[model samples]
Target chain A: MSSSSAAPGRGDGAEKPPMRDALVAAAFRLFLERGYEQTTVDDVVALAGVGRRSFFRCFPSEDDAVFPDHERCLADMTAFLAAGADDEPVRRVCAAARPVLRMHAENPAFSVRRYRLTESVPGLRAYESSVVRRYERAPAGYLRARFAGPRDGALRADVIAAAVVAAHHNALRSWLRSDGKGDAEAAVDHALGQVRAAFGAGPVAAAGKGPEDVVVVVSRRGAPLWRVVQELETALGRG
Target chain B: MSSSSAAPGRGDGAEKPPMRDALVAAAFRLFLERGYEQTTVDDVVALAGVGRRSFFRCFPSEDDAVFPDHERCLADMTAFLAAGADDEPVRRVCAAARPVLRMHAENPAFSVRRYRLTESVPGLRAYESSVVRRYERAPAGYLRARFAGPRDGALRADVIAAAVVAAHHNALRSWLRSDGKGDAEAAVDHALGQVRAAFGAGPVAAAGKGPEDVVVVVSRRGAPLWRVVQELETALGRG
Candidate 1:
């Protein structure tokens, strides 16, 4: 909708546009045409019909322009995780990833273009990695606080948090690599399902030995009896 | 050993000292004394008694000096993983992390100091995240290639790779935060053990069902029998 309003560089006769939108549109256009490195802050402002002060007000630097919405998305994710229930921490974290997925899905062309650009640029790749880590930390920090215990709870929190982020990225990247075609929601859900299957035991199984105990192991139906017994023992922490 | 020969800036008599080492020493000294931002490349060259050419030859930038050995360690890890047998991808990846732990362990004082410095500097933290992501990619790429099959193998590979890195960082950070005191090897091993338990099933268990199957589930001793049955069914993929 914003793109149709006025051409990026061409100052179409209209009321003064939103500076942030104009700057972002101009920056992305310049980046795609001349490459990220070749495009400068002045180029962005010149195209947007703005000055250096306006550009700096919108973005800290040229690199920040490439990822204009990360701060907003990160804040939303942190707030989502903060509002999660004490129970089902893993599920809550998984749910928190939805907004991110939606943000990309809402703008498929931009997401795909950004993904390709990031893949080609080392600095952008590094900056993207930091952004990804911040997202990971939000969930991991939440889980760490919720699962604060002397046992392996802290480790579990970190592992599950990393796993969730990995799965989300896996699904999202696959969709992006496909140029944003196909059912991204289903792809994300399927990926999340695998995470749940792998780590969805929740606090119940993690508590490991209430007053009573039950041990179940899954292996090949035709597995040798001894192997089954050994697996059971291993699962029970005996072997 | 290098530290004992001469004070970093004093330049004690020694024929043709290693320019790389000298630059690093000078840079760290200045960084400590004046803070990372306050120190300049000229200051480092002046203290090291080296030219700008020599400093640039040794380090691409000031940040690169802070992580002098990452390239060598990364190469070592890649070679270790490359030599791995096809059947034990998880174990091989786990083994690949050992050298990194050893790198930190070999220089406790330097590692602790670098940890403190990185903790205080946002630039360094972002740089470190990028470094950590590189390490994560090596193992994840290995697993993705090895687990190149259906049934969430890619997802599993990515998740496990992330989990291993997270566990390693958790253990390493705890040790560094303690000023590198205590048994870091044992701590890393324990952390890796949790990763193995949580995600060690590898591609074999990940294959789902074979000709036959056995399902095992463990619950608290006092858990209801029905809950045990339900968990067993879920583990068996029936529920």
Candidate 2:
């Protein structure tokens, strides 16, 4: 994962392709040395040996370069989810979340620095959050497609997506907090396991079985009496 | 739920003083009338009869005022979670989420207008993202505290919190998309119910039981397994 070289000029600097990676490396170096607030676009440009126009052409804003290639990763993840053959699309969606971990693993140092910066800076924090919203929506949409029925499967899909993201986020956040030195991929898997455990431990396969088995038991007891009956029926049906 | 009165703000008028609700009303009205981008802090100040400095004083930025008293609400929720006697804090945390829905319900029009503005304006959208981050963190922290045992309960708590917020956001976004008309509280309740069903439906009282009877399992099904197992073992143990 660490061996993959940073791609230059995917978004900006079409004429001078190398300027994009150069700017990223330059920006991270400068950010570390001068601190994020003190470092300007001019500093990054000067260090990267690129003109101001070239820098802006590569990255619309200074903050944009700090994070890894989220746009590309998101597209890849979307394609992966779309390409699933399994009828259990939620599992496929969960499987697709692995790429996000792989992405962070590709550049652990950059990921760590980006984590530190987002935590300290509000604008970057907002940018990071917007990216997370996008990440969450992909799986949510996929789950919705998978779980679609007459019921509020939209809500179910959204929660499943949320739990998946939540798991990923917890993994990522804890790993970042550990300065990316920890096993982020394992953390993500652990997080997703929680998602699976939360939504899994019962008759969800019946999701495709139709909305007839899907009862909304509102009482927050250990489990509603009806859910117990439903599970017994599901187990008996399986037997 | 809709009848809950707005609380008095801190005397500084910056930290949500007495006239906070009035300012929110004035700001939303101006946003609707003149358009959100065209409307200025000055316009909000003029309509609310507060000084320009006071508007800035109340909200560090104009975008901040679009939200209800989140700081106060977060604090209220934190207190609620801390004080809960439920051994399983996840249930208590889910219960605590209702205050957020109640806050929106109390001022449906204001929430609706804010939602419209945020959807249209990039700046407000950024601000909204930051607010959602806060929403995710509170339960994440509470869940972390309760489930920080040797097992991966910490990750479970974090994911549960994330799912809870995702459900809340999904419901809130749907209501906002619908222009805040009709059963937003119901939508939110449905969303929260999904969270409770996923995470909180487990056997909460199993903490006191012996490990052999606890029977921790993870399945790909969507039913509440922990409770089902608890009930099964309880039945089988007696048999």
Candidate 3:
């Protein structure tokens, strides 16, 4: 999101940046001064001192102006996931989610303001959900490719992907609600740690199962080996 | 959903059901014959042999007509989750999600048709996401209450809720994509079992962590409990 002020690489250096940033600045100013629904593309362009064609060239819709860098973040995340062929699937996917948080954290005050702005508008809220749904697809697609053979491969991918996104989002939301102060990375790391603990695979697959077959336990971190064994037994109702 | 044909208990069955059902039926017929954007509230009422007042009384907007039962389904799920005080958090939330699937399963042909309709219209797709977001809050809220003591309590609730919803939707989407032909319950059951395995807590607390704290491991099902512990030790790099 840091480079959102710079155009989407349609052009580079000194030509497109000012107009793009001006339009974004103008849109938020007007949106804050006179509510989101009350503002229009024409009003934004008028404030930005640009023509209507320029506005359309930069943003497909008014909502796009509200969330400028999602496309870049999504592409970066997709590329990152694509490059990780040998890593653990759950861990790789959780790491893949980091760039998204970085996008929001790159400009904390703007992200915080946008969070409040999105909360206030129904259209923007739905638009935000659709954007998030798009983010979830990249890691899910990656995991699906990795777990392609199991009958439940798609199901596992979907659930783990959702867990990673939810955990990251839960952490991000808390940080934003606190006015985007403190260490966003730490909050997200702690939250993503929960996902890893809950969904991560072992160094070796379960001993007697098929290579793709598995059983999982939701256990505590840092516990001694024997107690974790007891917890697994209790979870399976075998103790 | 079967009873979406009935009023929202706004009134009894003597007169409201036929008119309410007629509005929905007429709206869908017109939406299919003419495109959703091409059709209007006036056309729906006119086709139903009713006035605009009758239409608005039954549904607040055209989108609501497309997904008429979500409100009822959401209410049913919230009540179901609210009553599960003594159950394990993840398992209870998974059960709470069943009502939503049952709503779709209750009327499979209509669900398949509606899924197609939703796919074709971006506006309706966003609207549907908002509705699904509403359903997620019920279990998340319930789990949040059940897990209020720990610092990561809210985070656990959010991630577990997302996992449950994603698994259920994955199952439901496959069933709907199959033209709603098979046993939806069995499909949903299989998918949600993945959630139970991935996120479900042990029967007892971990030996060293707080009773409210937890750690979880995702592994294979039906494996020996000792194998699950081994997987955990391996995941934690203690092996």
Candidate 4:
């Protein structure tokens, strides 16, 4: 998407430690200077002062270098969830969602840059979807394990995971739209809190009295709306 | 990715007034027979016995032809939601979600084939994400409009939309994993019902008193957990 290809970073920050970081930084430098598809691994290694083995070691493809922090963030999130005590599951997952938002907040310029770069390329947009799906799986795995007993546990896990991710992104979008100048943590916390309020163990459960006696209605699956309403009315003793 | 590149269909079902459908059928035959990359617009037109204009009229890109029915399904869903009269919005969105699942169910083999085809191609998988986003936006738009009053209304709408979509797909995946042989409607209804339970205007409201008085514990937005719990216990007169 950038206008022209240029020789980028001839021996800039070549002495950096952690060969992986050097390769990714150099890749992003060249990737921005000389569009995504136009740059090659050879070009990246030359600027990075690393070997092709090192380049491949750091990135799957040129586009993948744009998101260099997801693996670390995902690992930290997994470890955080794994170390958690038996807190409420919905609250726990909402807690687990913070590290991801914080990861983006840590480097607004980099994320903003990557955001614009990704929006410009169809291939990168596709690649972004794959990256997102990877993050979605972590919370989903934790919830699936926690909610394993119910028949709908897996479905619940998937829905809650998706809700968390969607809410997280919704908040992040506002922060990024402000060019990363807004309070990301507050926005994300507020958004995830909404998810918790909806899916969390409710005030009824928190009060330690069961919710069933309040009202209960049962209807066969695939019943018509009228029939289901009739069943509910009958349950309320009003039919 | 199909194995080899070869010429495909010549004048099969050319008389169909639904020129769009024929063009897509022809494109798929060639895309599967040859490779997706190997097939070109010119080749598709030659095989379908249609002019180049017709092919371009029907699809945006070569990959766009795969999801032939989404626009129609989206229109039907939008109309269904628009026509809904004063129903509970969460349940309305869930009810609105069915036609999309049914659209896929209407043609199991075609969906099964598209599923396999999409999985085999990364670009198609990316395209699938865009298509799914389109569907997600429908429920999201409806919810945003309906819940427009509160400050968090938009965020609530978004996460709920994502939850419904995730549940819908979870059930759809079961049906698709069965090679589209499973009962998609029953599965989807069950999944969406879970969403309804989580987000519905509860039986408390149905019992005709607002849900506000069940256990009201007011706390500041950014209050610490202990402070909030202290406030809650004070509200319950146990402080």
Candidate 5:
């Protein structure tokens, strides 16, 4: 849960660098030079100029440091969603995803390196997958807040959030595999577009509508003719 | 990969069942009778009437025996999606999800028991999350196939897939948490409906050949006046 916090040690007047981030940097460097299996916490702490106690305070385990602080990201995303304006709930989620996208963009080198390591290492990859899924849930939580019932609400949120995160991974993996050769931002945008498109093209029109005229749908290109007719039928109870 | 063989014993059938199923059943019963932490692999195997080697053969670890056989389910889903008629890609994916739904519904008792243990045990909950995310990937994989591309293919597929799975899990977790008290099928249908609605009420409308022609959206119910007007405007793009 503490991983959702954005900046480590933010409350104090003193601006101490995050021990977690330093350890991660050291670990990544060591992983690249000495290989992931060979590297140890003792080695990382020595390189980061941090004590084992400080390292332990920041992360519960050595492997935990290899990932981003998702707990903080989740909390920040929650706050971003909670603070969203009353209108355009889906858009608000997309906006929240932007920060996460930017976080990767800002640290492309480190991200690419981490991606390489995670890809090559199965244990790290699984751990990374688990961590990323937690981030995916943040947007899901937001969607749940704006939807009707838990069944659809939770699903809708999870789908929306998962899409965004999946897009990021696709882009990140592509970029990493290319050694950062590709347009990462473009990749992120492309991925976010899918999420936006799915939600935009979806039946959410009814979600925000009144009971008197309860059918909700926005006309979009590429939809089949009869399917539209079916929705119309379902909404009106007759074709 | 041997997990996909379906045939119970081919020497490669680690986690394949009758044996696997029995072990899971025994584990759940023991977890209920005692507690998850108190239960061991030996207890589960002994109850299932299998030796220690056989238990390990069916499950990689004690914790894994408790989870839904996602590898088998994922493979089944992938094969189902691959086998779908070209004309009904979405329907095929929907059909694929049915087995997953059925797998849960088939043994509501086991599913319920596993859910209880997972909820109570933090480690089990984490493992449960891992399995859920893996299930989400199947739909994502299907979506990727539906829109495989030189451009916009991956993004479109991944996001749609993510959303679809999110919807599925949302429905599933709700049912699981409720002790199988809720309508599981309805929950799945509602979640799928959200996917349909998100993708648009139906397939995208076809383009008109003539500039002067009015593109009328005839629905089961009459198309909303606003949507009709919008369609008309779209037909005659304001050049």
Candidate 6:
């Protein structure tokens, strides 16, 4: 079928909005029906009733089509962090993650489809990791800038950014694995809350004390009572 | 030049040790001289005095050649964690990271060369992320097993595992960026120490007290005195 005959509303002079949507819809349909690897650019264009040129203009590659607006979401997140207030770095990073979560949550079916596709394909999984690394670097870089002074500031920034991203992924994946039926917002909020508590981003650290005054400690469960008392005494003495 | 003429000692009956070493050396030399993309498996084989079959046997692909022993290293790490005692999960995870760090540190020249190549090539970077993810999952899985009871056990496992891996990467990257010239052992020690401190693996939580009895609050520096006082009062009251 020719482009004009197959898709009546689409023409050479038609605006980008419907054409883009049609292309994405068609591409996803083909990917789901025939598998991501089996589907070709020609197949997508034929199904969408658009020319090859229009397809390329919309998506640089087949993989690009699967994640059409990641770049935009990333840019939005960067902007959100760039405009963040100086004091609440953890809050800013967590907030920066919202757009990404919403991007997945808003399109439950598409996100779930893409998630399954990525899970099955090693190449797509690598591509997805690269995309996730970009999202992680954004927050890490922002936190690195904010945490410029201490010796371990860069390290702290990186690990916390990684934790935030990991939490976001954990929540998003759980929701996706459930076929997107549950309350995603609550899941994400609970996940991010765990991150905040684990990282200790409460009123104390957020108030901006130097590192010398704060000595956080972590131990495994079920220590001897005497050991706990001794450690507590040491910690209290240090404080 | 023919394989026999270029590498006099290599032949069909030759043992695997020298052939593997020769192939790696030849591949690295070519990758450095001509760039990674510009070098091919044929070039590597011809230079190493090996046939195509041998190259494929030793390494699945050119990218795989760049990271020859990651599989072995990952296996070693997994074994290390698997044999760990039940009480010290953090220590076990941190110890598991040492093999990977040692793998890079023991062969500084090759590690640096590969690091530079990965930095220049987007594909290699993605490949590297996949490799790193495997390492991250090892500890995350181990921690998840240990933290099985708590509601947020899985989340804690993943984030802490991410933090451990991030600290390892941060230290490793810093060492690599410095051209492998540094007290890498000390750098890693300090980095992991920060992870241990920030995550709060202390005596109190390890002693099995409920969340209400354990008032582990983190406050910021430069908080209003009254706010700090009020928080302290509230925490004390709760405890």
Query: What is the Cα-based lDDT of residue B82 in candidate 4?
Result: 88
Cα lDDT of candidate 5 equals: 0.63
List runs of model 1 lying over 4 Å from the truth. Answer: A1-17, A202-239, B1-17, B201-239
Model 4 stretches astray by more than 4 angstroms: A1-54, A79-87, A119-123, A202-239, B1-23, B26-54, B78-87, B202-239
CA lDDT scores, all candidates in order: 0.75, 0.68, 0.77, 0.70, 0.63, 0.73
Per-residue lDDT tens digits of candidate 4, residues A1-239?
Answer: 12121112212223334666666677777767888888888998888787888777777767666676677678888988887758777778888888788777766776676777777877677777766766778888999999899788899899999999889988987788788997999999888866765565422232343434333333322323323333433333322
Tens digit per residue, CA lDDT, model 5, B1-239: 12321222222235444776677677777776888889888898888888999988777878787764666777877777777647455545555677677677656766776677787986677676667667767766776776676476666566556666766777888898888877898888777755655452333334563323334443222333324333533543420
Q: Model 1, residue A208: what's the lDDT?
A: 43
Which candidate achieves the best DockQ against the true structure? 1
Candidates 2 and 4, the one with greater DockQ? 2
Tens-place lDDT per residue, model 3, A80-172, is 999999988888998998888887786787888889989988888888888877878899999999989977889889888988999999999
- Residues A1-239, candidate 2, lDDT per residue (tens digit)? 12223433332323435667788888877776778889999998988888999888777788778864786779988999888856465567778888788777766766776788678877778888877888888988888887778476788788788778877887888898887787777778766755654454422444356423433222223443324434543452331
When 1 and 4 are scored with DockQ, the better candidate is: 1
Using TM-score as the measure, name the better of candidate 3 and candidate 6: 3
Model 1 — interface RMS deviation?
Answer: 7.5
Please identify model 5 stretches exceeding 4 Å from their true place: A1-22, A29-51, A148-155, A201-239, B1-19, B29-51, B200-239
Model 1, DockQ value? Answer: 0.38
Error of 5 at B222 (Å): 21
Question: What TM-score does candidate 3 get on C-alpha atoms?
Answer: 0.81
Which 10 consecutive residues of model 5 chain B have the lowest summed lDDT? B1-10
For residues B1-239, write the lDDT of model 1, one tens digit per residue: 25732222211233434787777778777787789989889998999898998888877888888887777678988998988856467767887899898878877888888899899988889999999999999999999888888567788799889999999999999999999999999999888866654555322332446745555456664443333434543464432
Kindly list the per-residue Cα lDDT of model 6 for residues A104-139, writing each as its tens digit.
776677778788978987767877887888989999
RMSD of each: 8.0, 7.9, 7.7, 10.1, 9.1, 8.3
Candidate 1 retains true contacts at a fraction of: 0.65
Each candidate structure's TM-score, on Cα atoms with residue i matched to residue i, is 0.81, 0.76, 0.81, 0.70, 0.73, 0.78
Provide the lDDT at B112 for model 6: 80
